[model samples]
Target: MLKTAAAAATGSALSSLGLRAASASTPRRGGTLRIGLGHGNSTDSYDPATFIGGFMQAFSFARYNCLTEIAADGSLAPELAESWEPSSDAKQWVFNLRKSVEFHNGKTMDAQDVIASINHHRGPESTSAMKPVVDQIAEIRSDGPNRVILTLEHGNADFAYTLSDYHMVIAPAHEETIDWQSGVGTGGYVVDSFDPGIRAALSRHENYWKENAAYFDNVEMLTIADANARISALLSGQLDVIDRIPFATASRVKSLANVKLVEVTGSQHYSFAMNTQFAPFDDNDVRLALKYAIDREKLVQNVLSGHGRVANDHPIGPAYRYEATQLEQRVYDPDRARSLLKKAGHDSLTVELSAADAAFSGAVDAATLFREAAASAGITINVKREPNDGYWSDVWMKKPFSAVFWRGRPTEDWMFSTVYIGKSPWNDTFWENESFARVVNEARTELDEGRRRSLYAEAQALVRDEGGAIIPMFANYLSATNLNVEHPERLAASDDLDGMRLAERWWFKS
Candidate 1:
């Protein structure tokens, strides 16, 4: 019920980015849409919390429905939950579930299902990456069959937006537990065959509640981690749509008569995370030296092909409401890096940087560029080209230094709580600052806009100067699709492929 006007303005923003304006036309259905993705892993799982790459994020939204959804225009909208109302303090939220919604397995979705599904990510035993978000819920209870109420431990102004996370898909409830392994949910499509890290096939759910949506008869998703392979599939007519278009090949793809390039500015960012818990990286001076050593400008021009803006060493971007734009932009300075290394009591520093294109297109090249730049500052960086197949499991977070990408959250608090918090399961850097913790926690409950922005500014400063994350650039969500596969004008900038809901929101033109 608290929809923002930002949705109405998203069309103009996308139009400026060269996305063809959508005309008013009837959508024709009944075609198999083949999608090529640049992300997936062999270690992926049925559990939503374990989802690491864009492939699983898109697949989850295609086959399962969250209580709430971030709409194509970047506004929060209802999905399984017909509507929601928040308490005056923004602590308690009550959601009214839609009636007669059936799961893929013919189970009727109700309040109990919502409760059980949410509980799957809560509790001390839960190892879900979203555990930090759900841990704020003090209690969850059903008012009736369709109404579910959640009371938070404290007032959180952005509590409702948290429910739209891809990991919050509701499943069929059975005796206080939900079955997630079966892939049964009240979504637009039902999974037919799933091969982790490779491909997935699904058919449209005939009983889907949302009418006039999900026009595709079937959807086949292919995991092509290599950037070249993904573009080849698109040009060869082997795929109808593709996500994560490589910036280097973007101009060439745009020139193809059969292709339509889609780009939207969002919170997506690329970073090099150094494990602060490990040696060498543990020293703040060493971390600052690394941060100053990399040339963000070169990465944006060379690696991103001038498609993104340089990022300060924090996750908050221009898209977020409370981005600390006033903070001094950190530029590459070899002398500063050397001074920081000396302050850390190191004459020279050497470290291996693990990278792969699976992290993002041109990630390995970015690592090589970073190595060359760091050499000027008495830092020796060894670029390790890791295999793309199991990079999420074997390299990311597991390795001391690695390339990573994030399809950032809609809200600042959600992003920080997920990856920057001390106890966050997906805190790849494993770094925490006391000042950051205090400001972020306080800002979560601060309802005043001016006061909240000030608190968040302090929080961003803390993360920029003290955290182990080296955020180099914020990239736009660039995708490519054949002209035959039609979509809405205002695409969601939240995640790639229309906020990872392309399978549900898009349709064939013929």
Candidate 2:
């Protein structure tokens, strides 16, 4: 069910933003729905191999069809490929492609295309998430026109689920060069136009195999960096849907009769990430002191307005199989924090807290909060804010010392492998522990669910004990949409715009 906050502050916030709450009963269709994207990074490549940005996920969901799709309940199900089965050893999986499926470019999807897509991501030039898993592929052979076989070096239980990832979407075999001009894939919609980092216009593919899919004739996604502007656009009817609704405005947006606020508890964990390779943070006591100084509860209640969940050290949520139950009770303790600082030979330590303006829900304010909290623990913090432009590419990823904003994955292995694995390209922290690495490796191959869960719990405990990451809060994704749009309940933490947006099911209420 949808929850609404009835406070006057929410109403005032909406009024200030020039938005009226949309009525719950209103419904309309056939009109082009404009969406305000809160943040937009580079996603110029149509090739799945090079696509990694959030904007790419939105675009891929609409235009590319993966072999499998994650269902509403987070279970893997067949999509472009009808069904698949793994060999007893789990080293090989065979997929039977759906014959009825065809690309928006009017070409029938074949086993060759699937094999080509997989190979493309496996090539030396690729930067796909499937790089790690695909590197183990010993061979990829097509059985016939519809069946494809994937032989890996070793067993991978999560192999099936990885096929459903947005990055693995199959593309035509003949696409020799990256072409954004003619972004083609076997999906429900065709790209009308793509203006990198600005807007992408998509038109429904009438030949879509899915019945009664993509209700909107056209979808105009506009990247709007300002929260106030996004709210204004939604209220003024310029946008039918909006993403990354400001927490300060969530209450106000919920009260508007003509607007519906959808909140999804996200896998994103906001943290003051320290480059463990450098400085005072390199010391365990210093890291522990910083973690104990900040109050996560206060951040959630006051800053986030109870929209998000409190996080301990691990980014993976409680629902994940490997979450450590014992660490759930870790809380703020300033006295302990001060003592830790003294133990680290720093009665008063000075450090720079770097954060990008574009990071976090209330990033600037969040940094301010951290500064204040550090002060209480007798630690000196110098807050540094960077511009949103090129922050991810030029600053966030390459920074030797900076705050980190990570959107977590559903599985513990995926989270650890991508971000914390010592040699991982995505390991921004540059912090590596041999014991943590060993646990991650064991968890990856552990076929038994219970055993794997235990491994992950131990891995998480190692992170907490060493203070690998300073997580303040688990972020909740909030969005405001016109009540005229139906199926607002489908949104999830994955930021699956096409799947969660439910654009196809929405209709006009006469």
Candidate 3:
């Protein structure tokens, strides 16, 4: 729906990124897989709360395991927790942990460890993003050695899916506090070294519980925020895997037979977020004007180089459950945009929109394109290029209007609760739809599939037409990998690089 360019252009663009074809190769173990990632900061911490991009997730998978994980095909699969079930009302849940899973520190995973890890984000001093998630839990206690029970304030049919969140990684517990600096977990690999924004090293855990994964003997995850640098690393035989490949340069990367680009369509959405509390943007009509002024199709075709699909002003892409598919896509209309601006008591409105490539692959270019399109609608948008180093902390939500990207949550309720909820710290737009809040709560507890679907459909409509984020495109996860790196046919679209499990599932084709 990107309202973007022609399909041929998209195909031509993707040909370079490796989505044009698939390969059949067998997995062989015992090789070091060097990975180059496109996002991270020197301030990055070992705490799961500090995770900012796919780079962190990839690194965490090297030493930690969540209760569940998102599979290559987007299904939730058990990890540390062997089995789980919910109460009749779905307000209470119990997880049976796998026994004898040992950490690198010689500690066995137990119910107490799980309880302590959950409490880390629940403590009063905790400022974790997962705080809101665990805040819903009234109690987390152990019934026995391998049994853990979680009592919720309300029913959540998808509560199990919540455990799949990367922030919920289970770490060793000591005196009600989690000892994460040790970086020990029952994962496929053990952390040999970690330097946040620079590079990380991990070696395969000989005692890893999962018998089928962690094929590589070692892995090195490098944070290269520059696209040029990431590409150069892959082309020059420096990295075996790299993600966030630029859409415009897909062809250049694809032409290399030793490497292939991987594209998986999912819930990733790119937007120019407006501070709904600010002027001009605070007015719904003005927001609508800005929305109508941007050409989504051209953005997908020209700016995204057809590597994405047009979004309908909402973060929930078509891959999301209960998406409002029947809703008419918002189209480009400069005259209508001008009319809306005039109605908002502004014949012409001038605003500064800060952006950087780190916001998305080509955000500066997209903002420039938007500026050209809005000029016809009597709107002057000054595209301010902000530095990528502090864009996340400085310009993203701090500015009145700026660019942001949402990888999206596994569930609709999770997505809304994480970003759109009025109290969420990541509520970049400061949008609070009263009806949507009520509907999301209902959908979370509604066990009736039909009723839940209806509730989500209503919620999606409100976000698409009235939300504060101007979602221009739902992009496919694009990454370039070497010919020797072998993974599953269906890869993870929810999280980059096979759900950041490349170290676990991939192998060298020797």
Against the true structure, candidate 3 reaches a TM-score of 0.94
* C-alpha lDDT (0 to 100) for residue 396 of candidate 2: 72
Number of the candidate with higher TM-score, 2 or 3:
3
lDDT value, residue 149 of candidate 2? 92
Instruction: Name the lDDT value of residue 138 in candidate 1.
Output: 99
Candidate 3, residue 483: CA error in Å? 1.3
Error of 3 at 171 (Å): 0.4
lDDT tens string, model 3, 20-57? 23665777779999999998788888887667678888
Candidate 1 global CA lDDT score: 0.87
Best by lDDT: 1
Lowest lDDT 10-mer window, candidate 2? 1-10
| Model 1: lDDT of residue 163 | 88
* Candidate 3 deviation (Cα RMSD): 5.6
RMSD of each: 2.1, 7.0, 5.6
Error of 3 at 351 (Å): 0.6
Per-residue CA lDDT of model 1 for 357-455, tens digit only, reads: 888889999999999999999999999999977788789999999999998888889999999999999999999777788899999988777898899
- For model 3 the local lDDT of residue 481 reads 89
| TM values, all candidates | 0.96, 0.89, 0.94
